[model samples]
Target chain A: MLQVIRNSLYFGGVAALSDVSFSVERGEIFALIGPNGAGKTSMLNCISGLYHLSAGRIVFDGKDITRLPAYKRAELGIARAFQNIELFKHMTVLENLMLGRHVRMKSGVLAGGIYWGKAQKEEVEHRYAVEEIIDFLEIEHVRNMPVGTLAYGLQKRVEVGRALALEPKLLLLDEPMAGMNSEEKEDMARFILDIHEERETTIVLIEHDMGVVMELSQHVAVLDFGMLIGFGTPEEIQANPKVIQAYLGEESLLEVQG
Target chain B: MTAVQSPFAIGCGDFRVNYTQDMAIYKNVRVRRRVIFLVILFFLFPILAPEYYVSLATMAGIASIGAIGLNILTGFTGQISLGVGAFLGVGGYASALLTTRLGIPFWFALPLSGIFTAGIGALFGIPSLRLKGLYLAMATLAAQVIIYFLFNHWDALTGGTGGLVVQRPSLAGFSLDSEMSYYYLMLVILILTALFTLNLFRSRVGRALVAVRDRDLAAEVMGIDLFKYKIIAFAVSSFFIGVSGSLMGHYTLVITPENYGTQISIEYLAMILIGGLGSVMGSIYGAAFITLLPVVLRELMTAVREVFPNLESIFIGIKEIIFGGIIIIFLIYESEGLAKMWRNLKDYIKLWPFSY
Candidate 1:
């Protein structure tokens, strides 16, 4: 359950997002689809609290989170995976995921220094949870490996696995399958389906793949030049002329549906 | 996670059978035994060696503490601080003032001095929230000048350029008047410092610090508050530096404004760089190497002077020259520092003559 109302963002004189609003129901996968530079990633960034909306309000599960800091938003069960793969590059996948559970861990510098007591117990508990995520993402073998040297698709999966480690109420994924091959895409789609079906997480996804978007998402919102042009179910979005015109340039989305 | 070799692996690996085993700091009994052996060897060295060498060991041990503190901030957290020398001075002065002026015991004064320096370090670290890289360096450089100015001009507190004097600390009612006893105290503290920091980097706090270093944005998304952690890093780092400074002052029975200048900060930086950034063991090796360089060169000069009297003047300043040259060579040859070299040595020995 998340709501965005009258969302607008600007950089100098240019509008990155303008008067865009949308709402997602609980336990549903929501899709934000648009052509290049159509503000989908910016919208995700805004809702995730990485970028503050210039004039808007974001309500997450009945809490006004528009002005909440990014870290605070994370504490409030919001997690995000970046399009550019913003994982901690030099740290191991295990450590990266452990960082996802940071808001939950209470150990401080002194406790961490003398780490055989409370800090060790907390670390082991979190490590077990992280290992479960590693199992879910099928990356158990690479748990100790630094993500910097990981392959692109694997790195992308680690990104999602990190977000999942938060046990988040709302998860934002930006272009998760952008550089993935068809088989990797299929695998990622399966993982997303499993997460939705099993965990019942509310996901907001930014994607360029028409088939994946239409098949996986229950609701789709199309943006064109910073404005919301269409908001409906998958079948309804495929038939909308404005979405057909602005998203995938008329023939491409129509061809996917056909 | 990739095609490259995982650096976290122990030699030949495959030992872990469970999650608890996997999370262990010492991967095997052999590694644990080896560490104990090395620590025992350190304790035995003073008994076997001369008092001169023992004094040198004390200095190296103190330097090790300061260098480790710098590594936590610069190496692990990726926050460059040019204010280490000033922070060390803060500790020395704070402890000296605490013990002499307030008549507090040495045990309590040491940690109190650390807290004092941490306060100052956090104050200087405030600019780091908005600055990075060279800009942050400049801000810390300003801290160096400002703290140094206080040390020189704050006559009532710091005694200005005349500095302060301290008595050797007594532990559990045992006065550490002898060089050997003091060396033992320094040794024990150094071991604790090493163990504490080694424990630190293996846990969640260390992970958060490294996350902030690698990508602050991603860390923020993961709920690691950047400002809070950065300030914590500053405070934690300075705490150790302050303790080190206090130890140095007590050992020498004197604390002066001249002791901690910009050159001292540069040397500490060199310690982390040469030892290996982000490594507790590397800090020790680097500090020992840097500390012993001048003394070793001086001894060699005396021995060579006996054989060839004409060669004496040519090597007059060779200690400084060799110090700069070794750091440069280390930078080019092994940027990861001596810790990496030590790891390579272990790997090589494990593989043996096969050389894979």
Candidate 2:
């Protein structure tokens, strides 16, 4: 489990995230949901080491990882899929997945230079890992296909598969179902649940889809204007007046009852 | 338990084979046999071919070495370098100086020159930390200009504008002064360098380079040091080019500043662009085509002049037009270069009887 403390992030002397705190439990699905500019992404960026904390610290599995670089965070069993789908366009799906196993690979330049003994063995082993992930994602057919040529939904799945190949303990899905259709969104939500249950990976998802978030996440945190308005179980978040006001306008709530 | 019958299964899971076996480079018995056959043919060609063809092959081999290196840095890394000739010149002039001026043997001078030039390349690459795209390319162009001036102005060290004559490398009391000897020498080294470079792509460093090329931010997020790897790519690329330069110097038995001009860099760029970027095989095909084009043109010109005496005046104009046309055609039609065309042709032939 990682503890994300009450953190404030300053952007150009303006508060991007002010006094926000949340903890992602071990092997559980956590959701951050709010309206536009709720600073949900800023909070994710802080945890991922993309943004420096102006105050407070992030302790991952009992180790303070606040100052670590983004890559260092990835190395420490944290992997993220971008909201915009940051797949390597020119590379094949297999090659993109193989890159995920790069951190797990131990061979240095000397072994690679000669391509003898252990390096070859290790490379073969890593290739198997990639193949397994490809199969798991049901993307075996498109293994050789360049990611740029794949559909947007498939590309997003491929990106998730790539991050999964890293074998991270904590997986961050930034708007994993943002632009997906109903069927695609259902498939993605199922995949996310499968990953959490099968791999025992703690997942933190940022999503605008309230129905999917309410259905999937065990813990939910609602933010409004870079501030945490509500944090608790899905049931608690659904019933909170503040959460309702953040989603539906205060005037609209009274009009609904009338 | 019943066996899995899916045609798309990873592989035939026999006792001795797996998915790795199915995707192997030397897959199956037939491929291994073909590879051995090809190796024999490659080794035997130089011995059987004529002296002029051997000379042309040698030029292709040397140029291929430089092209492969440039392909790695510019093509794979997406750095758009314009100072390949500068690096080549550094290697050639340094080796020439070490041998002719310092009284060192050519054998020692060759490798040392490569390292020396690589160091100079790293210095030039330092500017990359600040500049990018056209600005970065212009910075490298500036480096080429500076080196050209140094080669011209450094009178005592570089023999001024007169240039320096290089004594041929000797191995085990055998002087490699003859064209045949030089061809075989370059062929051996060229093969080794090419194979080394191919193996490089299979390594973690190579993957990191590709990652950086695709997305530097993502690469950094994956624990790869962007600046460190970029420099390493530059150093390795420069080293290969430098080695090729040493071979070029030994092959020609002369080192000149003019050989390392901006035009030469453009030719190197054109070779990779026309051949295919980031492809080792493309480098070979490109180098061979570019190197032999002039010779073929001269021969055609000679034949035309013999047949039609009036065509002599128009030769220069025709050559320029054809040269420009070829480049434009390749750019427009074959953006993936000859390698992709060759692959399609190969697939067509492989399934010829079936006619897919």
Candidate 3:
């Protein structure tokens, strides 16, 4: 459903990502694993159109989305939950989720201001959809609370809920389980599984937690120093010498065999 | 959507069943009735009050329109604008030029002037995509200076320092020439502006504006076009300010460069600050307070001067100091502004006798 063909991104004098290529089949949870500064987020940013690619192309659902704006990417069934929670802090969780459905809303300024006719109906419909996300994420308690006031784990859930509110065909979760407790990580893994299975959403997740990554992802791509060193199933990636070397120190190669 | 019953309810319980009921302007029938009563009282005030107070009401109403406009840009959209005075001038001049030069009717010129100001405001808003907060404010400040300069120097069009004369509007052959008639006109427009602004928050564009304000980057990633919304904010805000300016010009029968200088822009900013940011009702409260402050201060100063003739000159200077001082106090003690204070007071009253 999504293909990143030899995508490269540069920032100033440095190449954040270099010739990284990957493809995810539809309705699969794809994991991008890497150590600190391994270009996982950069790859997601490129695919989401937050950063312009220095080279190559991205095809999503058969369209070349290489030059599309971030919002255009969002409109084309792509949604992202940032590595750091990018939810609107001053807004309620519900408001943040409602804003996630912005591309679907059709009300212009004048019609929105009047808000008694078509605009009102659209708002209600979107609100209902947002409520389902709130329920699905079990964030009904914090639905009316401003996102800033929520705990980090709950805030991450809210961020995921916001992306889900898009009813996205492809959801990009950057470090969804980062900074989360074991219980929160488990819950997030479960939710990601549910989203993949029930909602049939194609998810590209960037996670540092190797355990969660191994358990949840159908396919795994490992990056080290802006290079995709391994791309395979969890079992294959675990046994790959390059993946093991990139993660464990070079001296720990014997430890991997042990 | 079952209505939950409150145990020992002190205030009215919200029994909203559907989205419409939940999002209703008033929470309940009682609140709606109370609002209607308040509106009725507002319309009746000019009839019962003295002519001077009626004139003050008209000015307050006009200021409210401009304040709401400023609030939409600065308060809701998080775009700090110091060019409100310029936008108002653009409207006033546009209306004046349209009526005087083009021989258009007052009714026609008024809306056209709003459109003209909106165009200018949108033009000024382009830099906001790259700039934020104080930088954007400085850009708008530049707009104020440029527009003000045009009003002063554009002799062939704006009549320069001599100013331009405006005729009161005649609607359906009934002239709105009297102060009472003009007050009614301003009051009606103020209500419509309030309603439109209030309803705006319930819909997509309003949420988008607030989202842009809260986090523009997040809004962008959520598929909200930041530039489009920001320009829309500027255009909508300037439209209201323009309409108010046109109304003011017609009411005063004159449009001058001095009327829409930087000081007036600061005053409009003060109105939203003191009233409340991101609140339609707060804009009205702030406008009324700021608009009436000078008159009230003058009265107070005159009364004090009568008692202490030696300190008469100091009282004249004290008004400006007190104005600055009050805003400072509000900023320090009640940064949420009068709307939050008013909400607290209402909550206090609701929980009266218990005093919690």
Candidate 4:
């Protein structure tokens, strides 16, 4: 469904993603894992059209969307959740998801102004779609609640729910399990797996948690100092020399502290 | 935390329920009936009330319509505009000029002037697509000053600082030259405007405006065109304010440049602030309160001055002091505004029998 072709580009006299490339198959859970400043998020941003590729092309679903705007990409069934959960805080959860259904909505400003006829019919249909996602996410009780009042973990889930409301062909989850407890991590992993297996949604996730990635992702891409060090299955990723070397220092430190 | 309940609680208890219930213009059956009753009252009051009271009510009705427009922009869209008077001025001048010079019928001039002013407001709001908050407010403020300047200096178009005399609007050969007829017409327009605005909240454009207001970046990511919605907000608001302006112009039989200036914009803001920001009924409550304040104060001032000679200036000073004080007190105590306070009081009475 997607691929990233990297090149030796200078980021303020430093190389960010150095001539690296990888392809993700449709309906697969692709995990991007790396240390801090590894440019994992940068690569995701390029894929999502938040930032333009400096030296390569981004072809998605047999179309070149390299120069498209973020919203345009979203219109083409590309949905992304931010690393720091970006929900419309003052708006109700329903309203937030309703906004997610923005691309699919067929009504124009003129139709909305009349508030009867076609607009009302379209609104009722959209409401049904949003309610289905709410039921799927098990957020029925807090459906009308403002996302701001929810706990951090629930907020992250709501963000995913919003992206799901888009019913995208490709979903980009940026650090969905960041700053979560073990219980929350399990919940998030289960949800991500459900998105991949049940909905047949192509998912590209940036995750720092090794266990979650190994358990949930079928393919893994490792980044180190803005370079693609490894790309393969979780088993292959664990056995990769560069991957082992990357985690060795942290592992030894924990051992020494113990 | 005391876990205090708001006196203004009307819908379901929590924010979630409150939000869902508020999505409806008339939340419950009772509210719907009340709205219908008010619509009837709007058309009836002019015929039923005395001439002076009818005039006052008409002015309130007109101002309320304008305030509702301002509320949509400032309260819902989170774009602070200090140029309601300027937009109104555009409408007033457009209607006055069209009716007097072009010989267009009053009925045609009213809506045409509104559309004309909306165009002008959209022009001013273009910078709004890129600017926000204090910057946007300043841009609108600059627009207000520029409009006022043009109104004063453009003698050819606006008849100079001497102002333009407006011919009363007539519909279907029936003259609205009298106060009663003007009042009735204004009342009908006001009710229609309010109803239109009420329905707007449930629509996509309205929802988009709210989304942009809450989190613009998120909305942009969600595929909402921020520039389009923001400008639409200004345009719709201008249309409503313009209609109020056109009505006022015809009713007064005079279109003075000074009448539509920064002071009136401030007065509208004060009404919204004192009444409640973002609440629909707040606009009406606030507009009525502010419109009637000077009159109420004048009565008190006259009585006080007569009882104690040489106290007129002091009473006037006290008016300004109290005016500022009220705004401050409301901001500090009930930041949600008087409408919230009103709602809370009603809720407290409704729930009084139950123990905490």
Q: Best lDDT goes to which candidate?
A: 1
Better of 1 and 4 by lDDT: 1
Look at candidate 1 and tell me the lDDT of residue A86.
Answer: 94
Question: What lDDT score belongs to each candidate, Candidate 1 first?
Answer: 0.91, 0.85, 0.90, 0.84
Count backbone clashes in candidate 2.
Answer: 1
Pitting candidate 3 against candidate 4, the one with the higher DockQ is 3
Question: How do the candidates score on chain B by TM-score?
Answer: 0.94, 0.91, 0.96, 0.90
lDDT tens readout by residue for model 4, B58-134: 88888998898899899888999999998889999999999999989888999999899889988999999888999
lDDT measured at residue A48 in model 1 versus the true structure, 0 to 100: 80
Clashing pairs in 2: A71-B221
In model 1, where do residues sit more than 4 Å from their true spots? A248-258, B1-14, B307-311
lDDT for A58 in candidate 2 is 93
- The recovered share of true contacts, given per candidate in order, is 0.85, 0.48, 0.84, 0.51
What does candidate 2's lDDT look like per residue over A1-258, in tens digits? 889888999988889899888898998999999898889888888888889999998999999999988878988999888888777788788878888887898876557656777877888888888888887888988998989999999999998998898999999889999889999999899999999999999999999998989899999988899999999999999878888887998986676556
Clashing pairs in 4: A6-A19, A6-A20, A7-A19, A144-B16, B7-B344, B8-B343, B8-B344
Angstrom error at residue A58, model 4? 2.7
TM-score of chain A of each: 0.96, 0.96, 0.97, 0.93
DockQ of each: 0.74, 0.51, 0.82, 0.47
Model 3 ranges off by over 4 Å: B1-12
- Consecutive 10-residue window with the lowest summed lDDT within model 2 chain A: A107-116
